[model samples]
Target: MTVALAISGLQKTYANGFRALKGIDLEVRQGDFFALLGPNGAGKSTVIRILCSLTAKTAGSVRIFGADIDRNFPLAKSFIGVAPQEFNASLFETPMQVVLNQAGYYGIRRPVAAARAEEDFARLGLWDKRNEQCRTLSGGMKRRLMIARALVHRPRILILDEPTAGLDVELRRLMWRFMTDINRRGTTLILTTHYLEEAESLCRSIAIIHRGELVVNTATRELLGRVDLETLVLELAAPLDQLPPSRFRLRRVDATTLEVDVRRETLLNAVFAELEQSAIRVIGMRNKTSRLESLFMGLVQGNEDSTRAAAAALSAAAGD
Candidate 1:
């Protein structure tokens, strides 16, 4: 497969001496829905900004469609579309006009821009509101408008930063379906969202970044399989002040429930055997598969643990 986006040794540092992005390398394959996961301030946005030319990278190289961003800015940028986290459309502009103007920025002719804008608005369920001022639209409508504007130019790569942030369940699902259709028709997508489940479902691969560094990048299935723990919540009919001594570890969540993190290999029978041995009645039981949320928390918190240790060492040295 062709490489749609590539970054090598990417680094970004602000004038305040805060390093926002450490040396990082990533590749987004053509026609793939690639999700980037990280906590706030994890440099996910930094990478997206650099790729979209919204911000300059302090160091490193980026190529879009094999065209170097720094060397061939126009060619590199032309193949990419960005729906930023912030809304930037003119409040007075109608939805149709907003998208049409975006197309014009890419040098698309007026007639073609108008036609494409109408088509996109209809497809995105914004056709009825085409002539309404952007400010008059609801939050979800505005978000859909942003997506329609991005699609105006028909870029090969779409970078959506928290695209479904405040959308309702139904609207969010609609957008997901639209995005999947776009991907199937050959658009490469790079998504950064707090909705980990959305990424887990939509992305073929994922890259997790933390504190300016790339921690893990692999296929979604592979990443999930690598994190071998699954959570089981057992609700007992009666309250238990303490847990029975058993081989399986358990954490009390409430008066009647206990949460257990069990390894996938031994989870099923071990849990049942332990419950049987203790004569604990399982009134209700729920199992949750390890997902991107757990995986991300593990990586981000794991990094924080190391950083805390290093800080403690530095503090001790200063005391001496």
Candidate 2:
């Protein structure tokens, strides 16, 4: 498979001596919808900025579709488009002017740039507001404007950092649909967002960063499968005075509900059979944590100690 992006031993340190990334090794294959996940200060933005040439990396190697970023900065940058987390557009410029000017920076002639800008604006639902100043648009519209600006270049790989941060549910879903379409058409996507649920739904593969260190990298399905125990809440038809003392561990969540931790190997039928014996009629059941959220928390929280301990090593190797 052709690799869309690759990073090896990536790291970043601020002037105040904060290590923002620690030897992060990651790859996103061509035509892949990938997610780069992390909490605040986890270096997700730093990584994106480095790739876009906005921020300098302290140490590491980065390649965009086989072009080394350092040796072939121009060509490598040409193949990438980035929509950063923060808005950086001019308030006085209209949507059309913002997009057209962005296209001009890449040296596209006026006619071609205008056509591409129109296509992007129309697709992103900004055709009507094309003449309105960016400052006049709503928060959601401005977010879409950033996306349009990024796509105007038609780069092979698109990196979006928290693209839907302040968008409402309906607008977020709209953007998801648009992104999914482009990804299907072979535009490799790297997404960083606080919306874990969105990541769970769109990304086929994921890599999670914690405290400047890479914690989890795997297929989305495999990540969810990391946790063997699933806490399920079962609604009982009848209220029980107390849980029947038995081998099956059950917690009385409420008058009509009970909670149980079910191992992956254990069948739901087995739990049903145990409840049947106790005369506890089961009406409904649901998992306490969605599969991805369970795995994310476990992986990040599980690495808490190791992440902190790596600091000494990071400092020792800084001069390299």
Candidate 3:
């Protein structure tokens, strides 16, 4: 597989001596939709900033498509597009102008930049608002504007830090469709979001950082495979006073609802067979919790000290 981005022994220590990242090593394959997840102050932003050159690394090396970022700055940077968490675009500028301005920064001529701007604006559902001042747009619209601006350059790698933070459910799903389309077209995407469901749905692979350390890195499915048990809530056809006597671990959530812990090693069919033999008719069933969420919590827990330290390091760096 072609490696789009690679980092080795990456470390970042702030002026106050707080370490934000401790020897991080990661690789993102070309054309992969990857998620870089972590709790607040878990060095997610620090890693992004360092990659985009907004913040310099204290040590270690970074390579984009095999080119060292520090040594081949311009060449490496040209392959990257970063949409930071904050809305950094000029609020006074129109959506049309915002994208066109970003295109200019990439040295695209007016005619070419105008075409890309039109395409991106239309694609992002900002075509009608193209002429309107960004300040007049809603919070969600502003986020879309940043995405359009980032894509205007058509970079190979896109890094989005919380791209849909304040968006409503409808807008969030709309963005998800857009993200899927772009990734399918071969743009490598690195996404960081607090919304685990979004990451679970969009990314094929994930790397979670906790306490400024790389805690979990694997394919989404593989990491989920590490989940040992799933609680299935079954809806019964008739209200049962007691759960069916079965070898499976089971409990009654309510009169009609039964909770069964399905172990990874046990066949779900076996659980059903036990219920069937006991004469409990199951009308429907559903997961009691999200698999990805269960794994994420398990991996990131017990790192409160690192969390607080990472937070302080970020604050100190910002103040500096």
How many pairs collide in each candidate, listed in order? 0, 0, 0
lDDT by residue for model 3 (1-320), tens:
99999999999998899999999999999999999987677898899899889888999999998889989988888888888877888889899898888888789898988898888888888899999998999888888888888888899998888877778888888888888899999999999976677777789988878767886677877656655567889999999997666788899989999998886798988888888888888999998864456545544575455545543433343342
lDDT of residue 137 for candidate 3:
94
Cα lDDT, all candidates:
0.83, 0.82, 0.83
Q: Give the per-residue lDDT digits (tens) of candidate 2, residues 214-282.
A: 766777776556545568999988898898866666899889989997777878787788889989898
Give the poorly placed runs of model 3, Cα more than 4 Å off: 237-244, 252-256, 298-320
Worst 10 residues of 1 by lDDT: 311-320
What residue pairs are clashing in model 1? none
Stretches of candidate 1 above 4 Å error?
Answer: 238-247, 250-255, 267-270, 288-292, 298-303, 306-320
Q: Model 3 Cα RMSD, Å?
A: 6.5
Candidate 3 has which clashing residue pairs, if any?
Answer: none
lDDT of model 3, residue 173: 84
Candidate 2, after superposition: displacement of residue 127 in Å?
1.3
Ordered by TM-score, highest first, the candidates read 2, 3, 1
